[model samples]
Target: MAVTITEVVLRDGLQDEPVVVAVADRVAIAEALVAAGLREIEAGSFVNPRRVPQMAGAEELFRQLPNPRTVRYSALALNARGVEHAVAAGVKQVNLVTSASQGHSRANAGRGVEEALRDLEPVVAAHPSVTFTAGISTAFVCPFDGEIAPEALLAVARRFAELGITRIGLADTLGTAEPEQVVRSLGVVRHELPDVDFSLHLHNAHGRALDTVDAAVELGVTRFDSAAGGYGGCPFAPGAHGNIATEELVAHLHARGVPTGVDEDALADAVTTVRVALARGRSL
Candidate 1:
């Protein structure tokens, strides 16, 4: 199966960054990503500017993105308000993230898992023009709540399934999941939800994010989330580090003869743009 890498550097990757990058630089980085053959990019998130100051001008950033008709620029929408903001900015794809762990859910979404899922239903119903992906954060473990049971993960996924959502993204928010743990959880979800499509959003804190990618590929998951410069981490989930770098993951998959359709040399230019932006320490 062909692999699809959704680069999340601008949203998930830059949100946890120290220096806030300006919107103009964000547009430059995104342009480079598209030039590198990234058809899908998590361009930004529509959340509280005060809460995640790094993502302050998301609407403005989306307005300035390149190749609007050809490239898929998605945004993370944490709630109904966020959905509204993204739609207003002309974002057609929305990533609805809810934590599988109740503790992280409250920390990230300011509600328990049930409340978070409950709120998503109306939001999904309200936005028929937008395409939504159900992203379950802390799919394997949570910093505050410990290991998430497989049943817990399935329950969260099933709720989204009932919403008629076909795509589900399982996240290892703490970067603590092992190969065996990956097989068990992902296998069961695929078995039970045969009609539902799945993807992985991994981190490299333990240096095993690639290993999990290998395991997921073994189970036929072709879609994986990555970052251009290996930049990522969760403000709510402690211990989470950068995502599996886009170039690193692409190289690993190519070495094994998997096709990703991304160019590494051009990807480096996108990565450099982020590094240069951080180096400048620019904001707003």
Candidate 2:
């Protein structure tokens, strides 16, 4: 089967960036990504506007995006209010970010993992019409608490599963996880959550993201999160940056005899669009 790549350039890629792309330009970027053959796109994050000014127009961006019914556009909703904002803006799907590491949970969300998941139970039950996916951040490694064990991931995944979230993404938030760590952590969670479909969200900071991808593919993973220009960083996780570049990921999959159905040429143009919007200079 072919892999499904969720283009996250609009949200995770720009959340930590200094240049705040305008809402109109963000819409153009989304159109370009769709043209590149991406079926699912993470358009923006519905968070505090002042906290993540780059994603300030998250709702408005969705309102301006073309082909709402045709494209599976999603947004990162950190809380119940964030989910409401995205739903009001016409989003049918959302990824709820939760950290498996207690330290990160406290730092990012000002709560423990258990507390965060407990609060989301009502949120998920209230929006039965909207599709929800759990983004388990710092699944393998946490910048604050050091290496995270597989049990941490399993605990968070178990909660999401209880909330009817069948799709969970295991993230290498610090990008410090080795290929073995990737397989080891995912192995434990997959065993207990047999019915759950898991995806990988890797960062390229240590250049092991591709290696982790290879290991996960061997475990039968078919979905991954990536951005066009290898752009992205964790606002809370220090020194956490770079998602595996989407074009490179597509090419790597193609070389491995896997079909991603992404047009590299069109994707290149999309990357250029992001560059111009962010006013690309000596940096990404």
Candidate 3:
């Protein structure tokens, strides 16, 4: 069976960069990844550009994105306003992220868990074409709260399910996760929410992302989120790398006899293209 890969270069990867990449470069990266057979890409975010200047022209980015219908293009949103921007910009999927921990949720989303869920109803109801994904940040552990329980994440997942959210993603925002932890955390939700299609958004801050993938795979999780050249770090979470590299994860799965349908040479080219673009002066 083939595992699905979602490239996060445009959203998560660009959020923490110091240099701004040109729109052409963004298009190039998206085109190359699609050409390499990636079916889903998180194209950009509708968040405030002042906070993440690297993603200044997200609406235009969606308009300029190549063959968006051929491959699913997604964006991250913090609230109803961001969801409105995503719908206006023509994104087919929008991800709403919060945390299981109240402290982290307040710091990142400016609301407690209950308030975040309350905002999600309008966001989901307003955009029927756009698939809504609730990403529970710091699903494993929190910088402020530390060692979040499995019950905490399960509660969030159940609420999203009740709210008619079609997709759910568990984010290791701070990278404080091991393989067993990954399996256990996701296993709990998978057992409880067997009908929910789930994905994992991982960071390589601890260099254990691949191992976490292994654990997730063992639990029958097939969808994963990654970035090119390992580029990206959470702007809100300090000291975290962007995400698992698409090339690296594809290569890992391929080596383990898992079919991912990604062209190895094409993935390498994406890494080179990103490095060269950054070297030549481009941000975004």
Candidate 4:
């Protein structure tokens, strides 16, 4: 099986960090990931600096990125203003995020699920040229609200499809989901939206991320979102930890004879660079 791994070290990986990484460092990290054979990278979120200080220089980071044609660089946008900022910043791709659970949606996006979906309508309509991927956070479980039903996730997936967003990512925001649950939920979504491509965004909080990956691959999911050196967490999702390590995910895929197209050695170097950058930022 072949898979496309989207490196998130520059965005979700650093969103909750105590020390904000410099734009130069973010760009360097992104370049390294591309060198490591990552074709897709989530550069940053177009959000308020006050809320997510680590992502304060997202525009600069995107503006300074080199070799734009080789890799697909994307940013996350929670609202219409964020989408506008991303569009103005020349972002070619954007991830529209909203939680599957209402409580988590309200906390993370400051609105209910339906309200947030309504907010994304115009953003999608306005950006016909830029690729948009809908990310349904807390698809498996929500910290504020317990295990979300599969129907709830499918509903959000349907909405994304209705909005002409064909690519969708299901996020285990709190990392509390088990393999069985992941399989069942993904199966339902896949059955309902057969045409939409699906990706898994997992967290390693409970150390079951790989198990979930195994389940996903069995179901023919070929896209995943991972962070370098396992650095990330959600400020709004209590008990959530870093995403599944990129190197670890790559190693697992390679061992299973799945072609991820990522060079393990180069990926390790990228991970080391990310770790060093974060450590250096902390010292300042």
Candidate 5:
């Protein structure tokens, strides 16, 4: 079996870091990930610099990075303005995110799930040329809203489908989901949204991300979102932790004979570069 691992180190990994990394270093990290054989990379989020200082120079960073033909670089967008920014920056792909849990939606996007979806309608309609992947945060548990029902997740997926978005990433936003919980919810969503290509965005807060991954693969999911060195968390989701480490996920997949097309040595180098850059930023 083969899986697509989307390297999120440049976007999700740095968003919550203590220090802001320079744009040049960010582009270097992105290039290194591509060199490591990653096919998809979430380059940055087109958000307010005041809200996420680490992702301030998203447009400039995109401008400086080399546009390779093989790798698909993507940016995160929360609203219409963000979609516009991504389009203006020449982003070919965008991940538009909303929360399944209402409380989380309010906190993260300042709107409820339905409202956020409504806001994204125009963004999606306007960007017909750009590939859009819809992500539902707190697909399992929410820090503010408790366990989310599978129906709620499916509802969000249906909305995305109606908007002509086929790919969806279900995120364990607070990293509190177990394998059984993941299997139950993902199973329901997959059954309901059979036409949607679903992916998992897991966090390693409880160290059960690998177990969830194993279960998801058995359930026929082949796409996953991960960060190098397990470095990521939602600044808006209380008690959230880093994403599942890209190296660890790749190792697990390879050991199970699931090809990821990523070079482990080069991935380690990219991780080291990210760590060094953050360390340097903190020391400054």
Candidate 6:
């Protein structure tokens, strides 16, 4: 089977940036990504401005997006309220994130892992038509807690499955995951959540991200998340730089004869936009 790529340049790219990208620019990037043959795009996040002012205009960004039929727009929601706002904004997918590490979960979500999962039930129930995917942060290891066991990640996935969430993503928040760990941890998760749709959210922290992506794809991971020009990371994730670039991932996949349906020239042009934005100390 072919791998499915989701463009996360707009959502994860702007998480820690200083400048706010105009609504028109966000829509422009989304339109460009759609034109590049990427059907799924994580457009923005529904979070508080006090924490992430860069994502302040998520609702407006959605409003300004070109309503394309072939593209599926998604947003990141931290809680039920955020999910409600995303659904109202006409997003088809809601990506909820939590960490297996108690310290990380508390620090990021203001609550423990269990509490975060419990809070997700209402959000999941409220949006029956919207697809809900739980992203487990620090799935391989944790910066604060350190050396997370495979069982820990499995336990969280089990809980998410119990909540009727079939789509799950394993995130390398700090970008320290090795290729061996990717295969081993994902092997166990695949066995446990056999029927669930799984994804890999890798960070290029150690520069082994491409190798890890290869291992994941070899292990039957079809869904993957990437950023344009390799933009974005957990502003809270210690020692993180950015996620794997969409162009880099596409190059690796396409060169290996994996069909991604992305035009190389168009993707290169998209990266130029990000390169220029970063040079200006901005994000898009």
| Comparing 2 and 6 on TM-score, the stronger one | 2
All candidates: TM-score: 0.98, 0.97, 0.95, 0.98, 0.98, 0.95
TM-score of 6: 0.95
* Candidate 4 lDDT score at position 155: 95
Q: Score residue 196 of candidate 5 by CA lDDT.
A: 91
Residue pair clashes in candidate 5: none
The lowest-lDDT stretch of 10 consecutive residues in candidate 1 is 275-284
The better-scoring model by lDDT among 1 and 3 is 1
List candidate 6 stretches off by more than 4 Å: 277-284
**Candidate that beats the other on lDDT, 1 or 4, i.e. the better one:** 4
Name every residue pair that clashes in candidate 3: 19-283, 20-282, 20-283, 20-284, 21-282, 21-283, 21-284, 232-242
Q: Compose the digit string of candidate 2's lDDT tens values, residues 158-226.
A: 989988899999888878889998899888999999999999998888888888888888889999999
Residue 41 local lDDT, model 4:
92
The per-model lDDT (C-alpha) reads 0.89, 0.88, 0.83, 0.90, 0.91, 0.83
Candidate 2 regions with alpha-carbon error over 4 angstroms = 280-284
RMSD of 1: 1.1
For residues 1-284, could you state the per-residue lDDT of candidate 3 as single tens digits? 67998888777887777787877888888888887888888988887777778887888889998886688888899888888988888787888877888878877778898898888777687667778877888888887888889999999889889878868989888776887887888888988998898889998877899998887887788899998888887777655666888888999999999998889898888778777666665534
lDDT by residue for model 1 (1-284), tens: 78999999999889898778888888989988999999999998999988889998998999899999999889998888888889999999999989999899999989899987877789898889898987999999999999888889999999999988999999988788887787799988888899999999998888888988988898899999999889999998888888889999999998999999998899888889888877775544
Off by over 4 Å in 4: 282-284
lDDT tens digits, residue span 38-71, model 4: 9899999998877888888777888899689888
Off by over 4 Å in 5: 282-284
75-173, model 6: which lDDT tens digit per residue? 888777788888888778888888978978877778899888888887787678887887899898787899778899999999889878898999888
RMSD of each: 1.1, 2.0, 1.6, 1.1, 1.2, 1.8
